[model samples]
Target: MIIRPRPHWIHLLFVRRGSLLPRILSQQIFVLLLSCAVVVVHGQLFHWKVTLTSAPFSLMGVALAIFLGFRINASYDRYWEARRLWGTVLIEGRNLARHALTLTGGGVDARPFVLGLIAFAMAMRNQFRGRPRQEGLEGLLPAETVARVQAARCAPALILLWLGQWLQGVREAGHLSPMLAQHMERSVDELSAALGGCERIANTPLPFTYTVILHRSSYLYCMMLPFGLVDTIGWMTPLVVGFVSYTFFALEALSDEIEEPFGTMPNDLALDAIVAGIEASLRELLGETPAPAPQPDAAFILN
Candidate 1:
């Protein structure tokens, strides 16, 4: 996502890289022009004056602001939960890697097991973003394992299955006791739960009808605002309408951008960076040299 040092107050007002202004600029301009036209005509249409008062708009604005607040809160909840689930994945992946190295009695090669944890994280990232499984798995996993994951309907779930099989094989080979294997198995189960949580959030979004109603209401309120203020504010009606419309439009766009936290939007969670960090941490746990951490782009977007 947009990761950068906070800008100065004046720069904050004019910053365009991560702002939502670009997405709603056209709408704001249209509303400003409409407001200007209404003011020029003195709130008249076809020789008939459209009389309106600010009192109703004041009440509607209050209600609309409250509803928009609720919508944004709901979207932020999803975004935060998704981030927490990834945090769980990172933690559990580290735990599994440590277990693979220490608890296997040094008789079993832990590289494959550690690599499986990384593969699971990559597969989950790809699945959430609707990408193909083979993008980065060829180098991390065996060809047969990658083939199995690619062919499976759920690549992350399949990788988890392979992980379980590895634990079982280690136990059977006398490299690990049954109790220790079960302990590592619990970490794998935690990874599974995290995977399922991410799946639920990705598959089930906020209801479409709710989004439609909120979108229509925001536009309707902005479009009808100029007439209400024209009679009272006179020449300043366009300026007032422009500012108000910008607030409503920007909030609506922000909600839409963050509703699906796994997306490639500037505001969405940085799944690419998150997956890379997980891989790096796991490799470090295995005493291997991890790759460099991902750097943000020139625009300060990490994904």
Candidate 2:
């Protein structure tokens, strides 16, 4: 997502990054052209007045806006929940690194466990965006371990399982106490919960039927809107309809993008940066320098 600070109030009028303008511009142009035609014809077909009243449209607009409001609310809930789950990942990752190293009393090399945490975050990020790249794992895991996970189903879960077994092995080797291992296991479980929560959001979406209904209704209302206004507004119908169409189209596009917060869109969550931050935190515990900072694209999006 775009990572820059909020623009100044005056500059906010001209904001582009994360703006809804790009997606809706074409549709708005079409609606505007349609409005112009409706104005030229004045809702008349073959000289028969296709009289349409603004009263019905005004009432319908209120109802449609309410439904759109509900959809936007639902989408924002998903977006916020995704953010919170990642926040959990960050906190739990840092905690795991500290607890694992300290409780092991330097008797065990913590690199493997630390790498497991990083791997889980990277794998989860890849799963969310459907961009599967394995280069990030080379620094964190051995070739053999990476090769084994590359073929596994739910690679993150599998890597976590290996970490659990590693902890068990350390316990057997007389490094970690059973209690410390159990505590570490709970952190892993919370990580699992966070992952499961994100998967739920990513895999599940707003119902298809609702989307269909909303889309058709929006188009119908916008197209028919000029008919309702052409008689009353006359030559100015295009300008007025264009402004109204912009609102409806922009809101709809915004809702669609934010509904799935894990995408590479400007408004979507910055999973790459979040994963990088997790890697940096874990690597620090391993006495490694921080990961290089993530830079935003020309649109100021950190995908």
Candidate 3:
């Protein structure tokens, strides 16, 4: 997901950050010790030695490669599903705010309602990441309503509740007709569906048994690899095994990081940016003198 080329030393540092370094290095050390033992024992046993087989490499290599492929494929599916759901949320949020503002002929103060929609988007993003909703809702919500929504267990639902109440209030004040209220309520329903889709992706994951099996099998294969190659390749086994282990294990860690895209990861969904965009769009609709600019990244990254 990081598109630009990194400097050589920086890329080297990332090898440790990949989460596979500890396991791979531990396995490598164990293999080195085992190789030393074999050399020592063979010298004592009248120059007898055991060489690893290339046949198992050919067969198990194909099988293990296939398993890793399947695991990556499943993880990508989950990542893409999360992205699609959030994209739907962005669209539905704009529609809800637009409906509330224009549906009443722009007579009432739609700024609060429009800001509420933006706040809802940020709240949903924070909810998924298990973060506190303190910052993003500031300009986008009334003080009293923001406090209430912050105290509520489900932030998205609380935002929807506020939207419903506002629509009801508009009707009571003879600002909007019941028919328009119904139409606005249907728009809220679409936003709710988008929230539900997001929750579905977060709650359900690929089967636990399958994930455990792949991880266990991968570790076993990695542990056995140096032993299988040592007799022939000798010290060269470390370099080869290290490179191969890095590839497989790095991919595994990358998949885990991206599988849930709402988190505070490098390749996560740009929720902050997206919510800021919604605010800009709504403020433009309100005919504000100076519409707020898009959220700027701090050092090329959103905090």
Candidate 4:
């Protein structure tokens, strides 16, 4: 996701990196050219003067803006919900690492449990981003464990199973008492719930019909806007249409990008950085030097 510092107002007006302008530029240009043609023809088609007025467009624009606002709010809700789920994953991961280190008796190596948490986070990220299940698991987990996770249909769920098994082994070996094991198991359950939440969001998107209706409405409104305004605004129709179309197009594009927060879009969630942070926190809890935190790229984007 875009992670740059806020810029000055003047620079912000021209900023391209994280803005929806790039995505909607083509639509904006098309609307501008269409408006120019309408103005040139004086809102006529085949020698027939198309009698139109801005009254209908004004009313329609208001309704369209309201619907676009609603769509954007819905998309943002999904994005924020995904971020909260990842936050829970991080918190529960840290809790699990701490329980493995302090709650368990001595000589119980907590590294494996902590590593499993890291692997789980990676698996979730890969699953959401539609990447290979075993893309980044080799160095984080044992060969056998990696193979098991790779083989499983749900890699994150399998890693959670392994984590539960590790806790059970600790309890069986007398390192973790039953009570403490149950307490730690609560964290595991929380992790499971968080993973389930992410999966739900990833699987169920905003209704396809709703999106299709909005998409068609936005484009149709822009396409016909020039005819409505050409007679009223004359040569200024193109400029007005360009500005209005840009607003509508940009909003639609922004909503599309953020609707699926797990995507690789510039506006999507920073899954790689989030998983890395979780790994660092768990490793630090285990008394190991955490890897350096991820930095945004030259364009100030963290994937």
Candidate 2 C-alpha lDDT tens digits along 185-288 = 99999999998999999989999888788888888999999989988889989988888888888888888999999998978998988999999888888898
For all predicted structures, in order, the TM-scores are 0.96, 0.93, 0.77, 0.95
- lDDT sort, best first: 4, 1, 2, 3
* Worst 10 contiguous positions by lDDT, candidate 1: 294-303
User: Which candidate leads the pack in TM-score?
Assistant: 1
lDDT of each: 0.88, 0.85, 0.71, 0.88
lDDT of 4 by residue, 202-278 (tens): 88999999889999999999999888888777998898888888888889899989999999998999998999899
In candidate 2, stretches whose alpha carbon ends up further than 4 angstroms from where it belongs are 295-303
> Any runs in candidate 4 off by more than 4 Å, and if so which?
298-303
Q: TM-score: which is higher, 2 or 4?
A: 4
lDDT, candidate 3, equals 0.71
Q: List the residue pairs that clash in candidate 2.
A: none
